[model samples]
Target: MSVLQRLLFARPAAAYPTHVPLTGLQQGALTVLSALGALASPRRADLVAAVGETSAGPALAALRRRMTLDPRGADILAERPRVTDALLRRAAALPPDTFGGAYAAFMGTRGFSADERPPVRFVADAELAYIVTRAREVHDFWHVLFGCHTNVQGEVALKAVEFLQTGLPMTALAVVAGELRLPAEQRAELNRTYLPWALQAGAQAADLMCIPYEKHLEDNLDELRRRYRIIIAPATAGAAARAGSPTPPLGAAPPGFEGLGPGVEGGTAAQLHETSGRLGPV
Candidate 1:
């Protein structure tokens, strides 16, 4: 992490005691401040820190439980693998339609860097902290799986999916705040086309934290989505790609990014939360 970034997110050398286990009052204060910061400057590191610090605990527990229940997920937690910028760059060179290829292309085409995501600091348990950190790092992989663009519209749509899937306050906050900031046309598009799709997909898809994305980089992207019960919305680039067809070039504007399919709210998100609360130590 850069020196400035470290200061922004409280990444001190001691790592523990220096930053973890914040008081409830401190957390609440940080949450409001960070949410405001995120609203003011979306995607900035400091702002991401604000949201991340406040909303990570429950998510970590849920993800940790997910990792324990599934063998693949268990392997991932044991391995503690991290996806780095170098890894994404390497993956980008693979066949265009493969998972690694798509991930690389997505990052390359969108001018994003994996290193931009901040690390966890507030979650008290070290293992859970790692889970939260892993979750943040794999966010773009979720984008790849859902086939959402990095645009504000796409982000809000994806945030809806994440909110349903993870029940993270930050994602919910992002959806509400991001909607307010969007142009009328885009906001209408989200409510009319994408929100329902994201909610539905998030409700149906398997717990995303269980998937060891690093292991599937070479797999066919569309096949992977099917295995995960993910459906791309009809008439979008993701849908076209999943149907074994070509999509528009990345340089062109993205269509309604319904990468995750469309609609009934259900018990999956709640179930994950319930299960996480009852988990035994791994």
Candidate 2:
């Protein structure tokens, strides 16, 4: 990046477009710098900029291709569903076990808002912008499906899985950088319990970004997992702390991610409660 570009990105308050087009070299520069900024503060605007710059194009193409192959996925592409505040509000009123209800409950309990995700920027193509936009918007839904918390550990682990699933360089960078910053015990837990499960689950599950989550808010969470062929990893020790669950510590699981579906290995459930458990909203 030029000195002027660096100066422009240095101030988070600087106005940047929602769709700032950039060349390959400019995007690469932004990705490196923004990745550094994101590591320092995960919520930094520049970091979000890096993620959008690095991951948007290929992810859009991948989602487009995957959507083309599956009937439900194709319908999602045709309709271009979005997760909006009004939609989340409607989901909040759903029965507790439903996907939307669980998502609302997760957000409410964690004091997170559905509209907090940064808008897509730096991708000029309208359709590609929408694809990346959808990816960012539904990130929290991934947390709910995979039972990951918004904590450092949870976010890092989720990033690892996201890298595996989306082939996004930014997510891969996040996983490496985030893991290096974790405390020793938490880092050990990630390596021992989360990483393997995440890889397996991410690999086995359907292309999550292609799913029309907006259309299935009323569906049962477990049924959605089954439909998507998702296999959630074991919860970390922090799961209960985040959820404030009252279940026996030994066998407890998070509310929405609990219960084994047909595709889930029976042993995975046993492993979930055996480890220290953790889960919260993203």
Candidate 3:
């Protein structure tokens, strides 16, 4: 075998059904090179996925263990549901106030495609591969839940939350690299406003991987956020407005949402406090 092949495929192929099995050195080199590529041009989703895949072994394993313990997450691992184009189309047809509807709007308004996210290639185990793929697919869902736009500020803020939630090294790198790309004032604004909110939200929210999003497509969006303890960052609301996709106002009780229950009208200060108290500590 050639030297490059030996380095890249040092391990036996039996363990990794979905990818080439690389040695530690090979994985590290790939991670560094891909990270540099992503840093130079954050729009390169391929490079970003490469960084995530090459650096994610330990983190993915930890996440898999956590998921195995949660009922919904465990079911998800067994069923292996994908965020397919058909699913997106179905979401697009739902009522505007529903979670799936909001996700459809977020993608349509920003011109993002469900197919844009690269598939997981480097993870060694089938389940871990699915975990990584699930994380990638649900990224836009995270955007809608947090009310974060697709701007640099919004992306960086969401990266902070992802890093905290998944312990993924690539997310931490993205947060740092993204911050460095911002101007002084924007960086300060991110730190002063979004970063704190992201940290708190990330730490307090439930295991998002546990959510069976497909089943909850019809659930009221605002109610979903409340149940999950997700507080949309104040800055995100304005950013969404500027992008001409103003967040559905809180406490909006348009007919159908009434069945979703009370507290949908407007998030009062007491309600916000109660949500925080319910989340308590991680």
Best by lDDT: 3
- Tell me the tens digit of each residue's lDDT in model 3 across 1-282: 888777765774745455767675777788899778866755555666677777787888899999999999999999999887789899888887889888787767645567655556667677887887788778778777877645566666777888889898877876786667666877788788878888998998888889898998999887888899886766545544665654544322221211111211222211211111111000
RMSD (CA, angstroms), candidate 1:
10.0
Better of 1 and 2 by TM-score: 1
Runs in model 2 lying further than 4 Å from the true structure: 1-17, 23-25, 39-43, 236-282
Q: What lDDT is obtained when candidate 2 is compared to the true structure?
A: 0.61
CA error at residue 238 for candidate 3, angstroms = 7.3
Winner on TM-score between 2 and 3 is: 3
Over 4 Å off, model 1:
1-21, 36-44, 234-282
Q: Give one digit per residue, the lDDT tens place, for model 1 in 173-248.
A: 6677666766677678779888988888899998887788888889987788889988555346555666566442
Task: Sort the candidates on TM-score, descending order.
Answer: 3, 1, 2
TM-score of each: 0.75, 0.73, 0.78
* CA lDDT, candidate 2, residue 103: 83
lDDT of all predictions = 0.63, 0.61, 0.68
Q: Candidate 3 at residue 35, lDDT?
A: 76
Q: Give the TM-score of candidate 3.
A: 0.78
